[model samples]
Target: MAANLFVIEAPGKRQALAQALRAAGVRDVLVLATIGHIGMNPQGFKPLAIDSEYRELAYRLKPDRERIAREIEDAARAAKHIYLASDDDQEGDVIARDVMRWCIPEEDKGKVLRVRLKSLAPSEVRAALAGAAPFEDASAARGDARRIVDRLIGSLSSDEGAVGRVQGSLLLELQSKTPVAGVMTYVAPAADGRGDWTAQLPVFAGAAVPDEIQAIAPLAVGASRQGTLANHVMAHDEILLSASLATERSLAEVSSALQGLYERGQMTYPRGKHCAVTPEAVRRITAIARASGAGFVPGLFTAVREPGGEHSHEAPNPMVIGLSLNRDLGLLPLDEQILVHVARRLIECGVPCEVQAPDPQQLRGLPAAAQGLAWRRRDAKGAVLWREPIKAGYRAWTSEQSLLHFMSKNDLGRPSTIVAHVSKFLNRDLVTQDFDLTKKGRDWSAHVGRLFGHQNLSKIIENYIEEHKKAPSLMVADMIEMCGLNNIPTDQQQDYEYEDFEISTGNFP
Candidate 1:
């Protein structure tokens, strides 16, 4: 007779488990999927109605779920034994609980087993089958606590606050906590009349910039290499935005140059998700940098990139160091050296700094409103503006900052899965940003806050779920309490209104 393996969700892991069990010599193994949950509160806020002491909390199978159930039932009929194998997370635990409620029967209860796992491998699968432990119904109960709380919140939130649904089918992935505090600036940059203000902009070797950048405002007048440089910044906005402001050369210039290269087909795109660096990529770019001879580092690097969204992910750009033009090109000037420092540091995480002589008067300017205005002599000790005065925009986040910049730091979300969550929301049109939230997005936020009680609703849900995990018996009570509290979206509430939900309008006379 065939044996069945019923997994509530995670087709990938379930498939792997099936393969591993078979490889381990457990023949007659048939793996099946549930897609997700089959049972949940069917209609309204009242989900706790009891029925025949089985707690018939009504749950209707979703269309996809019904299909999965049919397949599993067919498999179960052929099998003498069954296994509930799901993921390692709490969500997986809840899925198992649902599986037990549905597929397994009381008469054949002893023939079924729960297979716990950390990873899916032949050895692990074999070990699980041999030890077929009783279902940790309590563990699944913890997940039920979470599911119940989510349902309660979704069903009963009051009309005073707005409700927001983030991207991702599962709320656990989208929910997060952010810090409520941030740092304040109490200082200013050293004033050097000659200090090019554009250093605030960043640079890359082959970046591009438009000529209009230099004409954005008065700051562009006689700006370093104005005509050529602004184009460079526009050309290299990516690199410029990516570099530290503390560096000597205008990050604008560097980034713009990099952009120009790309637009001109001289370089590859900087914004990409590739982990593997091409050998030709390193060689061709390096040779060009050495020949055309740009950047403070003119000699060529071995070129290495890190994986995925880490702080210092590898850039596709090949870099060169020390052009060594001595008499011809001359040593990298103090300003130039600073610019290079910013670029190198931009690729890594955190702040980069170096000690330099401070212009006295510029030091004096630190205590005033001159902070915002263009530092004509914000640090002027007569004519020359001292270049290194703890400037606000001087030091900046690098490639690494993009990984940790928003969400967690801003108390928007957590680190583990925040990035993907934000990306998903962006894709779903649920959230928008330009330096901050758009009007529609802000309106949505207001709606959610109004419905959810203006307090930390995300935290409230998180705590509720966590508490339920520890005490399964608390689930029904918690869910009941949660659902009784109204806060669904106004649109959904209106559309599903009892009055709107009508039966046959025309009667047969």
Candidate 2:
């Protein structure tokens, strides 16, 4: 009898998921891994080809993945049913579609189905297989659009090394910003003698320190007001930021570790951008928190619904209730550290607390020297006199956390792609680890800024996805012209080549 085939993106998931499938009584199924994207053409000026008018995408298997492609084709030919279980996101949908186009024969196309395995838990895997559906064409189209647009931008501006819709904008944003001279932080012991509360002030060059602030060594607190803590759950970017800070690892390193935990079913999907967790997920986390003796307050966690429409994923949380991070699951020290942070976040989610601080209006009524010591009073000077906390609540955010939050708010890139973009910038020396732009980076940013201002490229892509949902077509030439980049050299204009994989127009419909 012909076997059923299940394809996934990560090789690490094959063993565990295969076991889960077996346990779920999913018989005669062969699990396979794509490793990652298979559409990259190393030798071509462009990674893939796009039809000038219809915006249809043509992809070629990378040389290194040729054997894997052949294996997929052979397996697909013999398989009774083929499940493209890569991922449920846009990138994953694109990968699934590409597998069908490049590997499965025309006759075998009907057997192909898309399965979204949000987690590798046995139940989730079983449910995903049971609910397998057709490939998401719109999501695949959006992924294709992103690839095409990024490739077109990079190829046209080959002189600049690597440029992307989001990456370029981020580079320009970094290049355009002026660095602050210094920062002053003030700390005071808690009124209840618990710990210290702190505040910060940014000092620019040539800015003078206020005499009043300098005089106030330990600021006195006046009338205090009670405030509720902002019950904010961590998003993907924030998790990355927190993990990176806690582990002293790079964002890329933390992301890799988190992905590893996810593959092993120790954590939820790591690339989720939302702060909300599903009601079921919240319940699981709460149970885990109680079992693990972590801080668990019933009905305290905020933001517990899917806010980003139907396709949006829940925030990352521990996958297994009472899962041990120290278990000998081949977890690295970094992975364990990151997993601990994730578990802590889940346990702490929705735990209510109160905060007490000096009233701003009351502080303003004080003498000039006392007023200079007010929290976040920049007018007097860039020095925070002191911060006294009456109650414990939310934790202070780090600089990197603030930056990632900003990036997320502005849609600089998806959670999955943001770390890679940052790593690319660092590897290419475009931006220093400290986020300062080098001369080359600055020059390139200036050039790209002239063609497409910061955020314009992302906006154009967004608009394209929204307007052309059916036949998403944004030609390279059209985008160039849209960006006011009309003076392209003749040689560079015609550099891209198309590899025909015998794709027929009928295949698309």
lDDT of each: 0.40, 0.62
- Cα lDDT of model 1 by residue, 1-509, tens digit: 46655553545345455556667777776767675556654444433222321132444445457677767766766678777766444666777767776666656666667765423333334555666667767767656555454444444323332233221112222223221112222232223333333222332212332111221122212222111101111112234333423232343344444434333322333332223333333443344334433331212232333221212213334333332221211255433433343333222211112213333344343433332333222212221112234333223233223322333333333322344444445543433222233454455455555444444544455556655455653564654456344322212111132333233222100
Query: Where is the poorest 10-residue window by lDDT in model 2?
Result: 377-386
RMSD in angstroms between candidate 1 and the native structure over all alpha carbons: 15.7
Best by TM-score: 2
The CA lDDT at 199 in model 2 is 58
Model 1 residue 403 distance off true place after TM-score fit, in angstroms: 10
- Per-residue error for 340 in candidate 1, Å, reads 30
- For each candidate in turn, the TM-score is 0.44, 0.76
Model 2 earns a TM-score of 0.76
TM-score of 1: 0.44
lDDT value, residue 408 of candidate 1: 33
lDDT of 2 at 98: 81
The clash count of every prediction, one per candidate, is: 74, 2
Of candidate 1, the 10-residue stretch with the lowest lDDT total is: 226-235
